[model samples]
Target: MSRIRPQVRISRRLSTTAGVAVTTATLLTAALSPAAHADTRPSRATAIENAAAALLAHAASLGLTSAENTSVRDVIVDKDGTQHVRYDRTYHQLPVLGGDFVVHLAPDGAYRSADRSTRAPISLASIVPKIASPEAAGLAVNALRAANLGTVLKQVKAKPELIVDALHGTPRLAWRTNAVGLDSLGNPVARTVLTDARTGAQIDAWDSIETAAGDGKSLYSGTVPLQTTPSGSSYQLKDPTRGNTYTGDAQGQTDACILSICISRAPAVLFTDADNHWGSGTTADRASAAVDAQYGTDETWDYYKNVQGRNGIGGDGKGSYNRVHYGSNYNNAFWDDSCFCMTYGDGDGTTFGPLVALDVAGHEMTHGVTSKTAALTYSGESGGLNEATSDVLGTLVEWYANNPSDPGDYLIGEKIVKPGFGHTALRYMDKPSKDGSSADYWSSSVGNLDVHYSSGVANHFAYLLAEGSGPKTINGVSYDSPTYNGSTITGIGRDKLGKIWYRALTVYMTSSTNYKGARTATLNAAKDLYGAGSTEYDTVAAAWSAVNVN
Candidate 1:
């Protein structure tokens, strides 16, 4: 149960928005009116092919290619004016998790999951639901195909067993948390800006969440916006400051309910169309894939917000974009240079699966946060600090989300581990020394292991700086973490530790910072948060000495 080979550990793929628009009522059908057909003469099947071909042409310009295209299977124009063209294979691609998807169109104007082998129809009425009345406004699979979309995977592999009906009509928008409500096309938004509906006087403050996404791009979501004048229309826009799940369990993470995120710079807000086409998978799972890639992104934003008084990813009071499920069972998760988005993989029941753990999610996304903030390189000691910064805050988020419903602890990757490999998670903070692979002290060669494992010393130091060197039980287990010089170091709590560490990461540490820099940073951060000669300051100094970090 204690030690296993690194091979089992090596098989895992590791981690890691913006905007607004207020407008008048606009129809969001993407513009659709069935092509005029003189009922007198029945339209030929070639007509269907031509239309589908045209749809693909539109898709080509959207960057869809190779495995992300679609194919038109059949077409049907029922007795009414509805056009339900059956797509034999509707391919999908998740930006984060490289997976695949195949869709089907129901005779009843609904889209369903396609069983490429049996051609069995899986109900789309469940996953995406049937909100678009005419269904004519839906994406033109054939046209998108012509543009850049591709076909179904030749080789099929097992995928997450998704029951579409589970996500049917209800659409699961903000299903768990509040009253403001989520919009129809999967955007969770609420109107907050309110004017007198009279004169545009200086009678009140600007209402509405500070940042908003999707609605700016949902050209098809037709809803009349609120007018500012008192005699005009008064719309209550969500206050980005008010709606965030910041203080408690949410700690910047989304609940099934809080649609209060201030996404300012997200690129794929409205016109974003994900393609879940790894090798063989479904789009839903691909959607799920994004969960791991950006889960901590929220944590990172929150960490900076609460700890550093920053906003969004850039700390510029803006937001960032994230795309998941880029391709099938992707073996890894990475942040790209161009988009600053996270990518992930679906595990093979061993090592690789959902990367939704609070810390893991934060750790990966923090890579970018670190890049933009500290610009820490991925080698030498600064790199170690960069990785540790994520782990430290990731754990902070876990604690911030601490609830009796789902109690929090100082273990990483615990949720994703299974029975084999001792079911042990990644690094342990309570007693970093307990994990044989991690270091209790920064060594000359401490940067030898994977960043995940090598950052243990810093993780250990964080624990000591906050909680102090002690023997205590966290969760169900108990352990005593050691300090290098064997000095009796006084510890604080995770929150205090977080404030100090965060200040250090953002204000002091540079790209080439090493262990010595970490010590100076902690001392400086403590001095900044508390007084220079305060207990917090001295404790930070003692903690560094105790851990031999200096």
Candidate 2:
């Protein structure tokens, strides 16, 4: 989840790409249990109309102009009668980049609050571009080459779209062009170059492709039930039961990426077999890794669906795909948003075994969830928070699975690490500094460190929040968490902690949320769930302070 600003190293891939993919057999074709609600609304259209009218009447409250047209994207009314209405905006008939906003209304149909991607208004100077589209495409291509990226320029498509500048300086008109190609590493790359329409000068550019996804006898998680779809004489890996979660074999190649691999040469073919029984527990069989990836994905899906009330990784009832045995002896795994899929590596046995372990899958899948929700940028303190979120959720998934062979613990990647390393795990939450690189306390220069290491502060904060600041044993593992301050604090329990963190991540936290902002977000979440000034809120504040985030 965290990477240094520029370089794309292998170690960075491991921390940033771990996640789960899920699958099901014919038996799991049942409908998902609908969330229980108390009150009923008149109709979806009526609710949308009511919310839209309210938003239009109070446009200034949301920093919107009267000229902007707002269209309802989706509306969700909670069991408590709270309505969350999401809308897309267009300025003077042109799409606005950061104009999306969500309006929350209380049961009384009164405005509660709103969440906007950008606080700046959308009124720009003009829609006409000073530079032509062809020249803009050339500018984007030149900018890509100027970055010294060890990749070739391929099909570059430049289209002019009117956008308001909110991230950098004052609001201004810009031409946004997206150039799609492949990096030197064979990874699919897309760069959105924002050029000043008045001057044709490049404002900014970022790598469009970012890695971010899950079922079944799973090779590592033991024999498990899977939902499958019948297709003539054979069955497909598709799981009608769990949002059509499917599996595909990369066969150690990138171009064959299915639902979840980025920059694949061709579409991934579903792994079909005469019998639905897939994989023996060894690498000699190709399906074994798919079994592991799918099983882990299923468990993670169930954990979020049953425990946290999330439908899928994106909170929508759509399943992501998984690819196994990707690249020959690849030493790492990753989740790419471009393909909406999860990819696995069969590690060189001497340094690491197969990377499809339960926690590893959970870690990577949670990355997708993070991108959809808080969307913490993969740099600075926010990046650290992104990685920490995966670690926390991944650990929870492991505990939820309750697998006998891989019992739950705060330790990560313990089973996958080779014996030659003498390392018990990749990182420890209770005492993260044990890794020698991770930081256990927040500091002024904390964001300067690698995102994975900087995440230790949040990881340490989570440990103290759930288990307190003292020596303890859990699930056969011993841990003694230290605090930046010498204050003794009591834990609020993992269940409550998980609820608070999930709420903060989904509702309160933003893309650029830092350590201090996180403390406030969790505190706000705790207050919302357990009442203001309650013991839970106090504990959240105390835990954050213990991590030197105050």
Instruction: Please name the candidate that would achieve the greatest TM-score relative to the true structure.
Output: 2
Model 2, span 428-510: residue lDDT tens: 99988897889999999998876778889999999899889999888889999988889898888888878888777776666
Model 2: lDDT of residue 544: 89
lDDT of every predicted structure (CA atoms): 0.42, 0.69
Candidate 1 structure quality by residue, lDDT tens digits, 1-550: 1111110001111111011111111111111123366553223243343333333443333223333333332232332323333222222211111111222233333433221212122222223322331221112222222222233311111111111111112112111111122222222222211111122111111111111001111111111111111212321111233122111111112212222322332232211122211111222423233332333455456566665454544444444444433223322334432344443333334554443445555555566555553445454465567667777876776676543322466776665555553536666875675656677777778865545555777888888876777788777656587778878777778889987886565545544466787787688668757879998888888777765676
lDDT of 1: 0.42
Model 2: how far is 283 from its true place, Å? 1.0
Candidate 2 segments exceeding 4 Å error: 1-47, 67-76, 87-100, 127-162, 172-219, 230-234, 256-266, 348-351, 419-424, 448-450
Model 1: worst 10 consecutive residues (lDDT sum): 1-10
